[model samples]
Target: MGSLQTNELTLSYGKEPIISDLNLSVPEGKITVFIGSNGSGKSTILRSLARLLKPERGSVLLDGHEILKLSTKEVAKKLAILPQSPESPEGLTVYQLVKQGRYPHQSWLKQWSKEDEEAVKHALRATSMTDFHDRPVDALSGGQRQRAWIAMTLAQGTDTILLDEPTTYLDLSHQIDVLDLLFSLNRVEKRTIVMVLHDLNLACRYADHMVAVHDRNIYSQGAPEDIVTKKMVEDVFGLSCDIHMDPIFGTPLCVPHGKGRQLLKEKKFTEKQRKATLVPE
Candidate 1:
């Protein structure tokens, strides 16, 4: 398994810093989810870890070595990253896009190898994109296109995969589908999976380690059951809510308090009054 960490890292776009003096360790061979409200630096932290954005003050380490000091190909061999809303050239077929993942492993003398072929095949199967291998990327539905991108990442054959908002723009069922695919990759393939997710309940359900980002720092991190609470929700998202167990998976379920018809409390009423207000049998 691969290890990724940040040490006292500070990151910024220009003059304004988004994250400051941050440290985090990604647990190997487990699914780690970063959750936060918009502009909270969850995606910024992920991009920094993948070396897509340079740190202003500190460094990102992969396998205990500074990632910026390593060769690009070396990093590609150990890690793969999928940025939000990745775009491929129009009319590119799924197979063609997925095969591009092998670029790091290819050489002029070995342009196409047996291992590359096998990896592409396995990735397609793993993502359930085998039947749609020849479909053009733009022609697929939202979920299928997202799966195709994931297949490309899987084809890289790296131990660690990082994704930013992988389920964005998908409906509820498709969001669940993408998350289940990633969960299987972590459980069966032992890939170190990390992602930024907007859905808090789904993050709680799927994350082996849940990190809540607030004010450009990690507010809390642990198993969701241990760290996610009503107070945490209020602190992180500024919402009042009740936390309950999911009926299907028994994970933490958040029921938010908002403007709507409110349920009246029967306990505050006398037995006679409560019965009098009840609908007639």
Candidate 2:
């Protein structure tokens, strides 16, 4: 299993740092989800981990070596990243898109091989895109397009996969479907999966390890049952909520507080009315 870790990492855009002095470890063969409110730097940290963004300071380590020092092809073989909203070329077929994942393993003299063919086929089957291999990428629905992208990532045959908001712009059913697929990959293939998720409940449900980012650093990290609390939700997301166990999964479920039809308070009624109502009951 491959390991990914950050050592005193700092990431910035221009002069302003988005994540500073963040040290994190992604457990091998586990699904880790980074969660936070918008602009809290969850995705920024994930991008840095995947070497998509160079850290302004410190280093990202893959298997105990600095990721920047590794050759691009070598890194690609060990790790694959799917960005937040990836766009493919116009009229590109799904098979063409997935075949690109084999680029890292190909050489001038070994452009096409049985191994490459097997990888692409497995990737397509894994993502359930085998039936849509001939379809244009732009012609597919949102969920299907996302699955196609994931197939490309799977074809890379990396032990570690990093995804930034893979479920973005997807409907509820699609989001669940995508998450289930990733979960299957992790369970069946033992891939190290790391992703950023906006939905706290879903994050808790799907993550084997949950990281909460706040104020440019990791606020808390552990199993969701241990890390997610009403206080943590209020402090990190600025939302008041009740935390409860998910009936089906036994995970933390956040029930946010907002203005809605709530039970009326007895104090709002006249004393005589309250007494009359209580007397009959």
Candidate 3:
């Protein structure tokens, strides 16, 4: 797989810089997640990596070459990006939306081919959206709609894929479904996957590598267990939280301190009792 990295990169809005002199590399063939509070430039850095936003200084490199120097089709052929809460054109069917991903590979000399068809087909199957291909994108459930969008990216036939806030607006079950799909993709296909996630626990659970963005640059990066801590959460999110090991995934879990009924006072609560207190009958 090709590599993606930033060398002293600087990003800006108009004239004010948001990410400055940031140098980081996305590990190929693994799942990497960027986490931080709002406006921490997670999306900005992601966009620049996809060439959706031009860097103000330095460079973003894809496969050891400056991304800006590559043609749009060239870059798209090697990488695909799905923006936050992607929208489809009105009346667009799931199949039609996924077919658009093959545009980068098409030309006047060569039109649709078996490779493109297989790509779309494989993407739909991989995302579990094959049954919804005939349905309109807007008609699917939130999770299904997100899956369709991811299918489009998969159809791009790229070694690396990037997404921004892919789980935004998804319900708890749907969020797990989506993340599980991505985790499977990385594990089975060995594709380089990078994304921005606001939920720290979920990010830690799925990410093989985690980057915490803060104050215009990366605050820390490494395996979730290595870099995720109480201080990192407090400093980056400006909230008090306790870091614990997730029993199921063995990843870092952030339990933020907040106002709630203290059931742990003076006695241990069994799982049944805890569920009884949290769940309304």
**What lDDT tens digits, residue by residue, belong to model 3 across residues 1-281?**
98999999999997889999999999999999999999999999999999989999999999999999999999999999999988889899999999999999999999999999999999999999998999999999999999999999999999999999999999999999999999988899988999999899999999999999999999999999999999999899998888888999999989887533344553366668868778332
User: How well does candidate 3 score on lDDT at residue 225?
Assistant: 98
Candidate 3 ranges beyond 4 A from true positions = 259-281
lDDT of 1 by residue, 218-243 (tens): 89999999999999999999989999
RMSD of each: 5.1, 5.3, 4.6
Query: TM-score of the candidate numbered 3?
Result: 0.92
Worst ten in a row by lDDT for model 3: 258-267
Q: For model 2, which pairs clash?
A: none
Output the worst ten-in-a-row residue range by lDDT, candidate 1: 258-267
Q: What is the lDDT of residue 199 in candidate 2?
A: 93
Which candidate model has the greater lDDT, 1 or 3? 3
Candidate lDDT values, in order: 0.92, 0.93, 0.93
The CA root-mean-square deviation of candidate 1, after full C-alpha superposition on the true structure, stands at 5.1
